[model samples]
Target: MRIGILGSGNVAKSLSRGFVARGDEVRLGTRTGSKAQLAAWIAEQHLAIAQGTLEGVTGWAEAIVLAMRGMANPETVRAAGEPAFRGKVVIDATNPLVWRADGFPSLGLPEPESAGARLQKDLPGAKVVKAFNTIGHAHMVRPQFANPPTMFICGDDPTAKTWVTELLRDFGWSSIVDVGGIERSRLLESLCVLWITCGMRLENWNIAMRLEQRI
Candidate 1:
């Protein structure tokens, strides 16, 4: 699989590493196309990931991952161009988090609207799935826990969700829950606030949510 991830941040790097580990060709899209900026990190990690401009990567990839900051979605879309995303499954791994002075974060968007929904609206031609937002980047792939955590995802397109679920399994997830359409992203984004609050209170940054079913 050819994966194009937008952003050069932690989330992008983590996902890129995971995809590469699974024998997928990964390319990271950055604001700048200069490979020199990410060359050192790539060599240090010893991963064969490529770097390119946003538009270039989007055109080259079979699938795209929006790993940019929540607020930067519009700009990212503009930078990558809308037409390039048509018929591609875009994994939205963003949270519309508004950080405050006390170090706590809140949702930037109001009810019934979320980053995932907005992305879907922005890229109507693409299949957008909300995922990888409720967990930390370090534990995104092959997380080790007493019990495997459930990856809750939502999207209007069932096929896209299915694709993401299979990818999650490849990344070592045994349990996955599809929480309905993109509108359900409101709930998942709120879940991120809860995750952050718990991490701050417990002073532990390595926590994940698990749904224990009675089945």
Candidate 2:
């Protein structure tokens, strides 16, 4: 699989490593069109990944991952060009976060409006799925816990969601829950706030959410 990740940040690097580990060709697309820092980091990590501009990577990838900051979604998509995303599955791993003076985070968007939902609107030609936002990047791939944590995802496209579910499995997630369409991202993004609050209070960044079923 050819995967294009938009952003050179921690989340993009983490997901690139996971994709490469799974034998997928990965590329890091930067919004700034400058690759000096990203190239150095790639060499330092000894990863088999390529770096390019947003538009170039989007055209080259079979699937795309939006790993940029939540507020930068519109700009990133505009730089990448929406036409390039048609017929592709785009994994939205962003959260509309606003930090308080005390350092706590809150959702920037109001009810019924979420990063995932906005991305879907921005790229109507692409299948957008909300995922990888409720947990830390450190535990994104193959999280180790007493019981496997659940990856909750939502999207309007059934095929896209199925593809993302399989990708999650490849990344070592055993339990995945589909919470519904992209609109449900409101709940999922809120879940991130809870996750962060717990981590801050417990002073632990390794925790993940799990769902236990009676069945």
**For residues 1-215, what per-residue lDDT tens digits would candidate 2 score against the true structure?**
99999998889999999999999999999976667888898999999898889999999999999999997899999999999999999999999899989999999988879999999999999999999999899889998999999999999999999999999999999999999999999999999999999999999999999999998
Give one digit per residue, the lDDT tens place, for model 1 in 1-215.
99999988889989999999999999999998766758788999999988999999999999999999998899999999999999999999999999989999999998888999999999999999999999999999999989998889999999999999999999999989999999999999999999999999999988999999897
Clash count list over all predictions: 0, 0
Q: How accurate is candidate 1 locally (lDDT)?
A: 0.94
Give the C-alpha miss distance for residue 102 in model 1, angstroms: 1.9
Candidate 2 error regions (>4 Å): none
Question: Which residue pairs in candidate 1 collide?
Answer: none
> All candidates' TM-scores?
0.97, 0.97
**Model 1 residue 84 CA deviation in Å:** 0.5
